[model samples]
Target: MSIVISNPPYNMKWQHPFFAQSQSRFDLGLPPENNANFAFVLSALDHSEKATFILPNAVLYTSNKDEFIVKKNLVDKNYLEAVISLPGNMFESTSIPTCILVFNKRKSHSYTQVIDLKGKETKEIRDQRGQYGKTNTNRVYKKELNVLSNDVIKEVLSVIESRKNEVGFTKSVSINDIKEQEYDLNPGKYIDTESVDNIHRPYEDIIKDLNRIIESKNGVKITINEKMAKDLEIYDLMQDFKQSKELNKNMNEMLKAVNPNLKIKKEDIAALSRNKEMKFEVKNFERVPEMIALFISMWKQFVMTLNNEENRLLVELRDALLPDLISGDIDVSQNEYDAKEDK
Candidate 1:
């Protein structure tokens, strides 16, 4: 068994320069500033049997064509075995998320193992020693760690042994599938990381929710009706007062037209009203209270009809602003309307 730990000199040239030439043939441009060594590492991985490597994450993923060519060559030759991603705070001195790559030429198992040890039980540093002391001084305790626990490791091993394709978190894909992602080795891209809620709620629960909604709507209607009733009473009183004033003006105009020289005072009106009441001539049914009641009833009916039409118009305007409930044409998730007001 051979293990190659490779981190080539940044400016070193390979023995066979065919891999460097491959970049040009593949139309991938030269690797950029201070980091052209990844091309040689790719060349080494192409020739070696098994290798362990350290690399910047950018080498694995970049929009540049040269990087793509190098990645494509390594993956196409089946040099990649497994990738282990570590937690962000592992490198205390620097601020970079690091990972370890294990590559192999031939494997006895169908899938490789990846154990993350970054957030495991950390040791306390006493003096310059690399060993832990009896009295703990570091921040991390054994209980407050998030390593690959025993149960987690067992589960991963079980899946690897069973060779079953699991969904979410962990899975295996063919080489062609990896190529489809353009040789990016990020687990998030391949893994189905979406949350899936599969539990079915009962019909009774839905009915209860709908009932609550209906009761809330009815409460709103009651409040609106109460306010409208008070407004209606005030509006009717004002309208009656306006109509009475107009009627008195019309009567005065009629009296002046009939007898232009007759100046009628309030006392004279009262005496005339009393004399008319005392005279009490026999009147036909057509000209009595029936005519007056009929005219008043006709006015009330006209007002009611007008109020109903006005309310209908207001309802139509409200409906135009609201979105349709069916088909989900608009997203009303928070019930916020996308309305703009003119200043």
Candidate 2:
């Protein structure tokens, strides 16, 4: 059996004469406008009975029209065997996350094994001298790194060999399911990482945790509200300053109309308002309205960032807890029975 394995350079533009003249291999679709990830895969498939390619994460779920067409074709033809989402920083040259695509031409099932090994790596701190150490110091520069464990490898192989679903780690997905998901091969979309924890705590405890989360979210809301109130007060001050400026302009026009010889200059008004040392301050104060507006814009953006962070936390909590709650893994029956007994 001929097997081809490669880690093709990602996002390379294919403009070579060979690529330009290649027509038969691009039956699925032409290499995308800017990416040749699938083009390399197709070339390998042409020469070998089975091919394994390490590709960037985008290749699995890129929405580019031509890329998606090729992906859909591969799924439809049952050419795709497995897609494994590896952890980040797996390569020294790039920090972009990667995945492995396994293809086979032999007779097999229509389903593909999708594995999510994102967090399977064990994190260790290594010193500048390449020795594993615990404490970080100036001379002993420390770096947190991930390494694939033997058990993770064995588990991945077992799932691929058995074609069984391993909850959050691996799953066998039918071609129809792939099509339903718009040909998205991202393993995280199908696997729920929280489910793998298998935490079977009491529902009361879960509810308490949720209440704390809600309280934290509410605190964020209160901070946002306070910022908004301050913003409104600033806006009102700006409006008042604008009205005062308008009145000063009208008064100047009236003075000019009343006495054609008399000049009602802004500098004259500043000279009358304060001392020589405060002249610069008075001049710069004219720009206070503009400064206020700019400050308000920046403050609003800061508030928006805070709000987005709060929303992100809420989304993460929901993703982590909802599955366990719905699956009945966090038992609620005990709490319900206790309540009834107390009543």
Which one is best on TM-score? 2
**Candidate 2's residue-wise lDDT over 1-343, tens digit each?**
8899999766666663465545667776776545678889888877788899998777887767988888888888899989998875465333345789999877368889999886588876666432222344335455555678898888887888899987678888888888888888888677655634644444333333333322222221111233344444433333333343344343333323323342212211111112222111212222233223324333332223223333333344445445655776544433321122112
- Which runs of model 2 end up more than 4 angstroms from their true locations? 16-22, 125-142, 192-343
Weakest ten-residue segment in model 2 by summed lDDT? 264-273
Provide TM-scores for the models.
0.39, 0.54
Q: What is the C-alpha local distance difference test score of candidate 1?
A: 0.40
lDDT of each: 0.40, 0.57
Supply every candidate's count of residue pairs whose N, Cα or C atoms clash at under 3 angstroms.
0, 0
For candidate 1, write residues 286-314 as lDDT tens digits: 12232223232222232332233223323
Pairs that collide in candidate 2 are: none
lDDT of 1 at 34: 29
Q: What's model 2's overall lDDT?
A: 0.57
